[model samples]
Target: MNGFKKFLFRGNLVELAVAVVVGAAFSGLVTAFVNSFIGPLIALVGGKPDFSDLAFTVNGTKFPYGGFLTALISFLIMAVVIYFLVVLPVAKLLERLIKAEEATERPCPHCLSDIPIKATRCKFCTSDLATAPTP
Candidate 1:
């Protein structure tokens, strides 16, 4: 029971659980948006909002292609939203953070290793950095 409790309360595990819950909630929101807004927009052009009824019979087997198309559209919309709203913004923010972090460090010319910007010696090679070129 102790091990179980530890596993349940582990930081990464808890974070993952929260992420899954949030992702599911976001998926539902995207689905609702597709159903409420995108469906009507498509209907304005296609004359129908619901596509599940569209099917074709082949050898007594029904293929619901319209439903697949509707799902595809929903998936595309979700992908676009996630990419623009989450992925792109996160990427840009990370890039900015990396640049800021990089600005605090400089390469040790003797060892070709990273050292603090104000470092006067190369920790790796024990070489004097007083005359090293500054980037």
Candidate 2:
């Protein structure tokens, strides 16, 4: 019971559950967007709102390639939306954070180790830093 409680309360598991829920919700939103907006846009250009009815008969067997095309378009749109709206912004934010963190530290010249920017001595090599050139 204790192990079960620990597992249930674990941070990673909770985060994963939240991510799954959010992803499902996002998928619904994207699907709706594709159906409502993208479908109409494609219809305007291609004269068809959907490709589900498109199929080819080969050797008395039918292959519906249009559905595959529609799905592929939806997947591409979702990829682009996620990349521009979510991934690109997150990457930029992380870059800014890394720069901010780097600003608070400097390399210890004598030891070539990272130390506080204002440090006057190299803790690792026990070398005096006052005479060292600041890069």
Candidate 3:
């Protein structure tokens, strides 16, 4: 029972669960907004937004291009929202974290080359320098 609780509530698992819930909620909002507002607006401009009934006779076959258009729009909206809301912020946050890590990993300024954090001298340049004490 304890093991199952731990497994379910681990830090990463908790975060993942929260993310899933938030994502679902966000998806619902986007879908609703598109259907109620954007769909009608687009339909007003372009005529009949729901294309499931749209058919074109090519030779003897009917091609449903309206459904394809709706699918394409939904895919585009999903891509834009995911990219702008999730991917961009996550990438920026990761970049900031990497920069913070790299700031500590860099070698001494005088040497202008990579050396251990505790190193007092630039190994390649052989220049003496003081290193800040590690707390």
TM-score for model 3? 0.53
Expressed as tens digits, the lDDT of each residue in 9-48 for candidate 2 is 9999999999999999998987787778877887899798
Per residue, candidate 3 scores C-alpha lDDT tens digits across 32-104 of 8667876787789978776677779989998888788779977786677678877999999999998677444
TM-score of 2: 0.76
- Provide the lDDT at 63 for model 2: 99
Query: In terms of lDDT, which candidate is strongest?
Result: 1
TM-score of every candidate: 0.76, 0.76, 0.53
Clashing residue pairs in candidate 1 are none
Candidate 1 vs 3: which has more TM-score: 1
Which residue pairs in model 2 clash with each other? Answer: none
Residue ranges of candidate 1 with Cα displaced over 4 Å: 94-102
Pick by lDDT: 1 or 3, better one: 1
lDDT string, candidate 1, 33-111, tens digits: 7778877887899898767788999999989898897777778877887788789999999999987864777888878
